[model samples]
Target: MTVTETTTAPAKIWDKAGGWQGVGTAVGILALTRVGQLLMIWWLGGATSEPRSVWDRLLVWDAGWFLRVAMDGYPHGYTYENGVLQGNELAFFPVYPMLIRFAAAIGFTPSTAAVLISWIASIGAAVALHLLGTSLYSKRAGWALVAICCSAPASVVLSMAYSESIFLALVAGMFVAAHRRAWWAAGLLGLLTALSRPTGAAAALGLGVAALIAVREIWKSENRIAWQPITAAAAALAGVPLYIGWVAWRVGDLDAWFKIQTAGWGTTFDYGSSTIKFLNTTLRTGDGWVSISIALMLLVALAAAGVALTQKPWLPLAVYGVVAMILVYGQAGFYHSKPRLLLPVLLTLLPAVVAASKARPRVAILSIVAWAAFGLWYGAYLVTVWPYTL
Candidate 1:
């Protein structure tokens, strides 16, 4: 079906889900997943030799970078450690830290504000995911999307001081807005999504595709252009370059942001050479279970994404998924972070969610529970026991 036609029955589908009641149920499922993951973190944290509170564990790795940006602001130029230039807070996006600062100004500590904002955004993400699913398919698909996404292996980031929650919320909301032809909302949300992370560029590209489709339909029907979609597309397409340009102007270097990312996190886009090498080595002789598991997850995700495409999802969604996967797979970075980076790529989860939505209630529930059991525990283990960054 065309994008416009697919969204025509949203009101009927929303009523079928009981409207707000269905939304509440999705949020409730998200809450349950959060509780389960937190409990796992608490248990795992206590058993570690260097036991720390669950709160502290949630604030590790990138959380510290975000908090630093919130509290101190980005550095003016390159940061150095022992005369070696390093990645600075400039590599991190500003929206999440800006929100953290805003929340902190109202009376909470930075860490508390960071986690609180993340939790709130995660709820928003769940709501948006439900609406997107319900609009495109059915209420069952909506709930299934929420349950699967919330219980994904790296979904623990949803509750932590990470920007993924806010990014997910904005991206999903933007998709819903675009699907509904709410160009104003889509443009604004698209802008925010772009400001959230580098991956936002992929989302903006997807939005651009949606806008193009709208424009073509308008031309075919009335021999006229749709200015709203065109304007929204322009706004979204501007987001990434705007931020990068600002960084360049501020730092007096054209590629300052890219430099910072490469220096700090080894995040250069190497066209998948690094990833292929890692997979080859890991499959051949990797010793660590974690490394091996991560390699396998990457393969499984690629397969799942392929399966999703065969199902012929919405055009914008499929575009976003393809580009996002390219960015994740083509990058030369932490091998273990691929799954976390893939969390907001809704396409990868479509197969399982659709299957669950079609199954009997008892069967679906048991299947999701089994998936969540390992997913929740695996995320908890990474944060509590793994020594490296997620």
Candidate 2:
């Protein structure tokens, strides 16, 4: 019996080391969680007489902008209709639209392509997140991280026509590459990520930090430094500026990107004053459960940051998460969407998972399940109740 147990333990270790077992489990969890989201949405819609088709439901708000961009390229200049300045496709990033266009070229409608791309990218994001979590800790932590990510309150965006999944997949891939010291892969992934979303620049920052770490290690050893690190660092730092510069050139203003975001969509960076005002107004008005939910989300983000500081597991991840939160919450616009914005900064969940793991086994399972249940409920609320610009 002892010999049989010893052999089985080695087999289990080998299975984990092989990588497929953990990834398969993570993907299964992701798929099942998504099904739960679908069922909840369907049931709620039926009960409330909302009766929205799945495609129609997914293509709301920003999804329309992406579809417009894919079907019709950016306008030449500021588009005004009947003396009112209308938001143009230029405000949206190019990578997602390009993907939509490619799918359209192959005979898929823009809307179908958008949903398809988002779902595929979501799966990729989950798998990549799993890989990154495993690389950072153990396979168990990897699975736990996936649970947090897939069930996030705003993770419904992952199944929509938004760039979140694309950006997340690339971000996770960049970090995984950085961890493996594959500088070229990290650099290229970071470049693509920068094209996907403005926050992609935060991922680049993380990559640059990783490169700096590699440099220090090289310095510690009396060995020759590799060109990979330098190239990766340069690429990571340059990708965002290059995209912003292109946008500026197109609009014929050096600060056109910021101008478009501000003038077109009312999104501007006011150094947190707007956020403060928003919180004050929400509190004063007593917006009920939604306000409480948003406040709780803010607390979760802060707690994650605090836990990361205490654990100090990975500096790049810590920096990436901190910067992402700053960008999400410190910005002036779309206060209601702040929780959604913070969804991609997935490292925030690591501390919670770590804490859970240290607890008694049944307690840990119950707590994690409760967290996931709350996430699912909150996500359902975002989709059904009090519509915000998610």
Candidate 3:
């Protein structure tokens, strides 16, 4: 047997995931998990709960802008009914709706296109996770990771017209390529992930740093300087300049974006002792009792996954896990949905899978099932109910 097959991780992880078997499994799981979310959106679409409050209100975050961009390319006017600004619409990235608009231009309804794209992207992510997991751990760990990922409430994002599903797919896929030294593929995926979300920079940075280290270790080889991660980082940084320039042109102020966030919305990025403060405040909130509990649990699960992750054959995973954790909960804000925001950081699962491979085969399977149940249920509630009203 070859190294991968004879060692621990199964050959399936590195097998051609685009093959019929991978495609079939990936498609099957995506369909089953996303059904609930698609049903909810289909059921609730165009239905009004109250005159002032429509289905859009329940959607919240970038969902409104997605629907708006779907209906209208980009509204020229601004409105501020809630505490957030409108018009500039910089809070919502352009890639997602750009796809929606492309679909609408070609004749697909925005909602329908969103569902299809998200499901496909989410399935792609699961396959990436599976490969990365099996490579790092055992075949069983990889499968378990995919199982948990599919069942987790985050699976619901695949149903909505949101960027998270696509974004996570790119993020996880890039890391898989990166771990295997597939620099060009990693860079391309990293670039896409960056364009898809604000945290794209973080993803690019992780991959780029990992690449630099890999080169140093493989310094004797001329082909080791793969520019993909570097290129991806540059592309991600490009978004900031492009976005800021647009904001400046619109408001005629150099700092228009920062000003809008503070003045128009009641948000300020102050890094005090606030991670703790946010947690303390959250605990005090009888308002978000369940949300607060879920948030804490996600954090705990991540930490547990980190511990399990570091035990793997790879050191890069441990490094990535440490930095990712610091980057995640390090924020000093108290948004009830902050845990969900860290969804793309699911790259941690790649390394965690490898670490988990050390477990006895039976025990590993048992552990995976348990984590899968908790993750799916916990993720489901977080996406559907908490942080947003029922």
Best candidate, lDDT: 1
| Model 2, position 296: C-alpha lDDT score | 68
Instruction: Flag regions of model 1 displaced more than 4 Å.
Output: 1-20
Clashing pairs in 1: none
Give Cα-based local distance difference scores for all models.
0.90, 0.77, 0.57
Model 2: clashing residue pairs?
none
User: Lowest-lDDT window of 10 residues in candidate 3?
Assistant: 2-11
TM-score of each: 0.96, 0.91, 0.75
Per-residue alpha-carbon lDDT of candidate 1 for residues 233-258, written as tens digits (9 for 90 to 100): 78888888998888999899999999
1 against 3, candidate with superior lDDT: 1
Q: Give the per-residue lDDT of model 2 (tens digit) for 132-250.
A: 77777766677777887888888888877889889989998888777767777888888888888888888888888887877767666646665676788788778778877887788
Highest-scoring model, TM-score: 1
| Model 1 lDDT, full chain set | 0.90
